[model samples]
Target: MTTLPDGLHDFLAEAGWAGGTIEPLPGDASFRRYFRLRDGERRAMLMHAPPPHEDPVPFLDVAAWLTANGMRAPAIHHAEPEAGWVLLEDFGDDRMRDWLDARPGDERAAYEAAVDALVQLHRLPPGPFAPYDMDAYLREVRLFTEWYAPAMGLTVDEAGHEAAWREALEPLLARQEPGVTVLRDYHAENIMLLDGRSGGPQGLIDFQDALVGHPAYDLVSLLQDARRDVSAALEAAMLDRYAAATGAQDDFRADYARLGAQRNAKIVGIFTRLAKRDRKPRYLAMIPRVWEAMERDLAHPALAPVARWFDANIPGDVRRAQGGKIA
Candidate 1:
């Protein structure tokens, strides 16, 4: 059995979960670790986020906001913010990705439900979160030059790259609609398929990094998933659904395309950093898909400036030069 972290045993015991069996759960690309605590028929998820690395307050606040707004976020049964531990409601093992894999026929329904959940979330008043503004956006994409470029044995002119990105992204940012609460990682893995739920079928997790951003941001994250394949047809259908539901059809496609490009660019850099710096090479395998998605997003006329910058800098050859195979 996996040894529980110090203080966790006593914490659970104090919370009436004494003598429960603890089993480690799969983690994401963050400092947080999850474990399943079971005591007879009762079960809860324990989140261990080491201090100085992560804080549980944002997650707790967001969960309460989501729940208050009639959305499905895990309930915080208990919390120890200073110690970075939280006991959350168990949403079960039905992560959307794994569930969809087992039932391919339900893909469309699952995606539609996910979109429905987003529609409900967008209806809620915006929360107090940092804006995903241009500065933040630029800072995130800089990870490309900072990490990926070096890994590819290429030299990056930081000033020149930033200038190009700024010129390319300025107009796009100006054209976006007002911001909303954007769950930064709204992909399939972080979404749970909970049936018979009042709020929605999707149970949200991993949303501590939520930000106020263009409504299209989470849509881009969902449709242009970095680690999974979402069919073009399904993506289009969901986009239509979201646009119609939220009355954001005006310039919606342009916004989607622009945000998709921005998001994929950021992911490439993040994945590269994860592989090289964090020593998690598994993320490297997802780069080609991200690059492919970025290329597709760049095909939109609205992304011309960004596309031109990418063509001049990263280019196809360097992007596809992985595993000795050209993508």
Candidate 2:
């Protein structure tokens, strides 16, 4: 049996879950850890988001907002934000990614549902979160220059990187209205396939970093997933579906491609940081996949400036990810 974290038992006891058996669940790239708590027929998910590194308040706030808006964010049963423990309604083990892996034929349906969930979410007004603005965008892309490039033993032109991204992301930043709530990480793994829920069957998790951003952002995050491969055909079809549903067909493709490039670039940097700074080398193996998606996005005309920057800075051979310990 896995040993529980200190004060976990007393904490659970305080929440009326004293004797529940706790079992750790697989974690994500972040510092948060999840566990299943069972006391006879009662069940809940315990999120251990230790302080100074992780915060449960944002998760609590976002969950309340989503559920209030008719979305399927997990219901929060109890929380002690200071210590970073939250007891949530368990949505079960059927993550969209794992589900599709087991039932390959259900890919289209699963993706459609995921896309529709975004559609439903996009229709709502912006949330009480920070805008995914230029500063934020540049900050994220800088991860590539700061971490990934150096780790790869390549010195990149940081000024050129920022200028190219600023130009490329200009269109996205010009939206007149406050954008929809972007569940920053809305990919397959963060989505749970809850049975029998209508209109919004997908259960959202890992959404503490939700932002008010362009509608295209979450779609890009979903289609150009870093952890999984979403095929080109499916990506195109879903893009079309979102555009059709939202009446955003005009320039929507450009925006999607642009965000895809930006997001993938950020992931490449984040993965490198995870490996080098945090000593989690496993994320290094995922860099190639992120690079492939970023390359695809760069092919679009919308990403010309950023693509040119890549052409000038990172060469073909160096663009590829290699397996090794970062010194």
Clashing pairs in 1: none
Candidate 1 local accuracy as lDDT?
0.82
TM-score for every candidate vs. truth?
0.94, 0.96
Q: State which candidate has the highest TM-score.
A: 2
After TM-score superposition, the amount by which residue 203's alpha carbon in candidate 2 deviates from its true location, in angstroms, is 0.5
- Top candidate on lDDT is 2
List model 2 lDDT by residue over 228-280, tens digit each: 88898999899889888989966777888888999989988898898888888
Clashing pairs in 2: none
For model 1, where is the 10-residue window of minimal lDDT?
Answer: 318-327
lDDT string for model 1 (164-278, tens) is 6676567656544466799999988989977733224789999988888777889899999988999899998999899888887557688788788788888888988888788
lDDT of 2 at 243: 82
